[model samples]
Target: MDLPIETTRLRLTELTLTDLADYENLIMIPEISVGAGFNLVSNPKMLGAVARRQVTAPNSFGIRVKGRLVGAILLHEQVGFDYQPDHANLELSYFLHPDWWHQGIMSEALIKLIEELTASKTIKTLNAEVFSSNQASKGVLKKAGFQKKTTLIDPLVSKEKVIYQRALR
Candidate 1:
């Protein structure tokens, strides 16, 4: 799959197997994973598995800075979700390098991605599960026009998460 998404100073592409090392390092960062659904680096094979899965998944994109893969922005199609009964929504997720913090690169990539995906008519609305402590991501979603749809307790993580929604139109 040839995934390429461009922003003023960043690119959002697809994840690859080579990302395991970086993903491992990133997972170890406390700030990056706080309230994140996954814990610290304990599964490299799982990361590889996800990369393989994303190669065929239409909605997942790897965010890049200066042509280097830095993070990922993901989406789960509405059809297979347990929340299918809720008026057509796809779940969104993102992660970035701690080095990229406060650079506005994510905000740029996010807005561009939302615009491109919506313009392509791939999805009508976007939703996100934001961990309460991950304020950086929460702000990105809000700036990208996502509004709080609801809050739910993630059974797996046992944490309060916010469900944010945004209409493409």
Candidate 2:
């Protein structure tokens, strides 16, 4: 996949350390943090450490609008899922600032990302697990062609989650 994939209203770029402050502000929002299963971190150092890991992760992109970071999208190896790590399977996760919600920003970003990854021909399936209550996220996934694969209680979070998957191959 390429860096800085752009859509009409947004830019998907490699997330960098420079985006730390904006990232912090984004995750500090209760709806975002709690919905994404992130514990609110009051310690700056801890937050920085977490941010560092996210920014450096492969396939992580900062969702920017007018040059301001407002959210992030990331694809990584499936962890607790049954899928094998064959490089063709990945888990998708993302969060957007509440202020940007309901405006189709996340759906646009996700659709573009799906197109790019599918064109790359290196990914076969993209999986996303959202808390059952996150209707907005489910809507975004559905808009991007993901279908609900299953519903189960996530052991890590102890919450009912809906698993969505998009096949590229």
- TM per candidate: 0.79, 0.90
Instruction: Report, for all candidates in order, the number of backbone clashes.
Output: 1, 0
Clashes of 2: 0
The local lDDT score (0 to 100) that residue 64 gets in candidate 2 is: 95
Alpha-carbon local distance difference test for all models: 0.72, 0.88
lDDT score at residue 22, model 2, on the 0-100 scale:
83
RMSD of candidate 2 to the truth, in angstroms, is 2.3
> For residues 1-169, could you state the per-residue lDDT of candidate 1 as single tens digits?
2348776688877655566556556655676556444553358677556546654565667777877777778777666456454334677777788789888888888898887877776467887888776688789888999899888887877888888999986
Q: Cα lDDT of model 2 overall?
A: 0.88
- The residue-by-residue lDDT of candidate 2 on 1-169, one tens digit each, is 7778998899999887788778878877888878876665668688778878888888889999999899999888764455455578899999988889999999999999889988999988999999998888899999999999999998877889999999998
Candidate 1 has a TM-score of 0.79
Q: Return the TM-score for candidate 2, rounded to 2 decimals.
A: 0.90
Name the runs in model 2 displaced over 4 angstroms.
Answer: 40-44, 79-85
In terms of TM-score, which candidate is strongest? 2
